[model samples]
Target: MNQLRDPCRSAGRTERGRTRARNEDAFLDCPQHGCWAVADGMGGHRAGDVASQWVISSLAALPRQSNFDQRLKAVRHCLRILDSRLGRALPLNASAPYAIMGSTVVALLLEGNRAACIWAGDSRCYLWRGQRLYQLSRDHSLQQQLMDTQRLTRQQAQSHPAARSLTRALGGRQPLMLEVLELCTRPGDVFLLCSDGLYQGLGLDALGRALSRGAPGQVVDRLFTEVLRGPAADDLTAVVVQP
Candidate 1:
């Protein structure tokens, strides 16, 4: 079976914290299939949870294969499938439109020592290697747009009201603007995929410190502690991938 030859192995864990009314985040770790992902959903209603589940399940259903191109193609295909379903599930002018029901997806597919990443919206993917952290994906959010046009300062954008407002996401009417990243993976390298809730409260410097000090699990716990020290406003989720 293809699964037996899978070169990647991973562990995924999640927690529902003290504040949010619902857990609208999802994650997956299928090391045998070389897939790992984190999705953060938006919507006041149950639509957020629904959107997140759809993304995770769709990605999980993709075939396990050795070819990188084929694996990436499957990832895009899964996203399209989610997009179509979301469109049918949430019409534009419905009485209770699920328009707000969208999600940011960050995923990595590892084959041997090479990794491919795909992202939509603001949920981020960071690569930590040799004590340096590199943000592998750009946020597709309103704050990012403002920054691009020089309309908002970086510090201001961090606290901007629309910082959480995503410009692109899965299940929206517009086509997804997916970013693909390819990088070499090392034995001691770490990859962090997390929701805005994790980043909003913990600055990059703090995050770097945590990553430098502990294992993947410990880093996640420290991050959660930092987040809880601040005002709790949204659901938080984090997935650390290390090999």
Candidate 2:
């Protein structure tokens, strides 16, 4: 007989940070559902927080599925519907360069030993194993495009004025293109889902050290403490999962 790994254990939190007027970030931490997500909203007065909250709320409402594939499909389906719905709600006369209401999402789904990551925009998912941390999601931003196509280093890409701009997101003028990555989880593996605010404020080394020595809750606390030590100019959110 084979031994089966236990389901995931998770913890999550969000903050307005020291500079943001409002925290336009939200998270879903459901170990029971084997689903976790972090959403970062984008927009102005229309309410970025609302958009992010809506994203997390919708994911939270998903019905439990019996298999990993079914749950993966359900999450993808939910984001697609949201993209259409949010796009339709945009003003017909909205023009270029205007801020559009939308949210960046990164979600993780776990079942037995399988895990899947679904995302749009720049929110991220990371895996921590064997004392090392690995980023599992790619950014959908101009900076990344420059790095990919022009072979520019991250520092060079950052020099571009619009490098931080998102190239894909829910409710943008163009249709959303979600990315998916599937992989098998090992026993005692740790996964982290976070908004840009959290990742940007802390380096990979800090993140790995935090994940190396604690439970989900302790790691989350360490992450927040480290980020808050800095300016934390934007809203921050993080979810840590271990199995």
- Best candidate (score: lDDT): 2
lDDT of 2 by residue, 1-243 (tens): 222245577899998967778899999998878889999998353567888888999999998876788889999999989888777665665464454678899999887878899999999999998888899999999999999999999999999999989988887768779999999988769999999999999999999988887889999999999999999988889999997
TM-score for candidate 2, please give it: 0.94
10 residues in a row with least lDDT, candidate 2? 1-10
Backbone clashes, candidate 1? 0
Query: What's the lDDT for candidate 1?
Result: 0.78
Error of 1 at 240 (Å): 0.7
TM agreement with the true structure for every prediction: 0.88, 0.94
**Regions of candidate 2 where Cα sits further than 4 Å from its true position:** 1-7, 43-45, 94-99
Q: Which regions of candidate 1 are displaced past 4 Å? A: 1-9, 94-100, 158-160
lDDT for residue 208 in candidate 1, whole number 0-100: 81
**lDDT score for residue 152 of model 1:** 77
- Model 1 misses residue 234 by how many Å? 1.4
